[model samples]
Target: MNGKPAVFLDRDGVINEDRGYVHRWEDFSFLPGAIDALRQLQQKGYLLVVITNQSAVARGLCTEADVLALHERMCAFLRERGIELAGIYHCPHHPQGSVSDYAIACACRKPEPGMILRAAQAHGIDLSRSLLVGDKISDLEAGRAAGIPSLYLVVPPGQDEDLSSLPGVQRVSGLSEVVERMFGSQAMPSS
Candidate 1:
């Protein structure tokens, strides 16, 4: 394991409420205490990397530039909270997408580990020491494939999904809880 650890995050559901193809800043909303959790992770020297699947681009719901704009807004919001992300990786392909060229089985999609592997290679991140926090089982599976030891599943309020059947994956109410588990009592209070 590398001395420095990284926190790989899922954009939708985990970082923000899964609002269904969030392609605009107006549609983006950060989950409760998410900024704080990210900042806490940053304070602990963990490189914050966002690995997300943006199939909306391929489905014709939005364009790549639209996704980038939303991400820019997200990064700006994080910056206001004093959190700097190391990198943001997104996969814009979907097997049954509407776009003419993007409709194909792509390795970069979630559950494939392509995005995570690419991020690891680009950032020189040690997967064994990294933690991946996501809201779906596919995220955990990708993390597993990428060799990320700590996998956190975030279940939002009123969400009926249960992932207890998955072994070696920890469940959390939100990113805040994951931060607590990672930093223990030493975790700083969110501003």
Candidate 2:
């Protein structure tokens, strides 16, 4: 497949409230302006993919099937909003997990860039031209390791997090700020 630019996103904290390992649909709440921001990005013709670390599965908080179910619902909801996701990838392994099946250290986990690398190969995404927006420093490191050109660190709403000015890293209060800068006053689709 010919290569195309894609936007790699982190699920927790960035997309939904980081309310501690959301495995249920009822507890999943979209952050304020998240849907609108997503719509704007969708309109901009970017291949949107979700990359997340779900060690809850390894910690026995939930099952892999539960995560898949939640993602199915998420994609359906996005479709209702006229947005399409290229893919949703999660790392279920934890180094110190209680569950034996998912306890081993894996490469897909954040700060490793394994998931991004796999997604790029699977979807033919041009890593050099792609972008990653996540809420943690690990996310930035993963994007950097994957060679994504644009990386934005999103701070959760109302968080008093202070990050030292880092070269090649832009800090954002939320997803809306990134959307505003990337698309300016254009590409926002009516919700």
Candidate 3:
């Protein structure tokens, strides 16, 4: 990596509660320790990039403007907590989607590396030195495809405990654990 390492975050489950088709600010809720973890990462000199898949736009559950509004609110909230997002990218396509224009499969989806690759190019990021924090298998795959060396999978609340079978990825209970693993205990500020 030319610069400091980066942490690419998945929006829905990693940053906010994965309420299905979350396009409205009213439905957004930051998960426990999310903002704190982000601030920690930021303090450690890690660029924070949010990469998400908003297929709900394709399903017509919400419009692109709604998604932008939601992101604006999310960014503002994070800024209030002293956390700043380096960049945000979201794919608004889904195969077999309800909306005719957005129904086709696209390269920016979770399983695809398009979004990550684009972010890397835009920000001059080195994927091999960066990490990805996500809550799903697709996120891991996308990170792998983008050549990121480390992938941290967040186990959702009430989900099964087993993670032994998730290959080539590290499983963490939450974003705090991820920060500890990536930045180490010494990287944390005194509480």
Candidate 4:
């Protein structure tokens, strides 16, 4: 397949509420308008891929199976809304993790770009034509390292960090604002 443009999304905060270490499906809640925003991007022919850091697995708060189960449920939920994700890549490793198997510095972790790089290669994505939306600086760093041209930082409610220092990164309130920035002032209908 010839390369195609994609939108790399961060799971927590950007896709759902970052309710610390959310492993159970019950705890997972999609941020308002996330589904619609993703659907709009999909309709525009951009592959939707999720690149996330599931360090809870490494910290022993949850197992890899648990994370996979949550992802399955999340994907099913999106599928019901006509939004299909091309791929979901997660890093279950951390340097100071308690789980012996996962307690090591890994390339796939955010700020490293391994997951984004793998997704690009796996899906034949054109990094130069793709965009990334994430809530953390590490997420943008990974996107930059992987050569994504556009980087959007979603600042969730109740948290405010001075991001004026980061050049080339666009700050957005949420997925709704992201869609607005991408498609202009016209409003998108929710699914």
Model 2 poorest 10 in a row by lDDT: 157-166
Q: Total clashes, candidate 3? A: 0
- 143: Cα error in model 1, Å: 0.3
Report how far off residue 40 is in candidate 1 (Å).
0.4
- The whole-model lDDT of each prediction reads 0.88, 0.88, 0.87, 0.92
Please write out the lDDT profile of model 4 over residues 17-109, one tens digit for every residue: 999999999999999888889999898889999999999999999999999999999999989889899999999999999999999998999
Candidate 2 lDDT, 17-51, residue by residue in tens: 98999999999999888888887787777799999
Quick one: best lDDT, which candidate? 4
Candidate 4: give its CA RMSD in angstroms: 1.6
Off by over 4 Å in 4: 185-187
**Per-model TM against the reference:** 0.94, 0.93, 0.92, 0.95
Error of 4 at 174 (Å): 0.7
Least well predicted 10-residue stretch by lDDT in candidate 4: 182-191
- Residue 167 alpha-carbon offset, candidate 2, angstroms: 2.3
Candidate number that wins on lDDT, 2 or 4:
4
Q: Please list the residue runs of candidate 1 whose C-alpha ends up more than 4 Å from where it truly belongs after superposition.
A: 1-3, 162-165
Scanning candidate 3 in windows of ten residues, the lowest lDDT window is 157-166
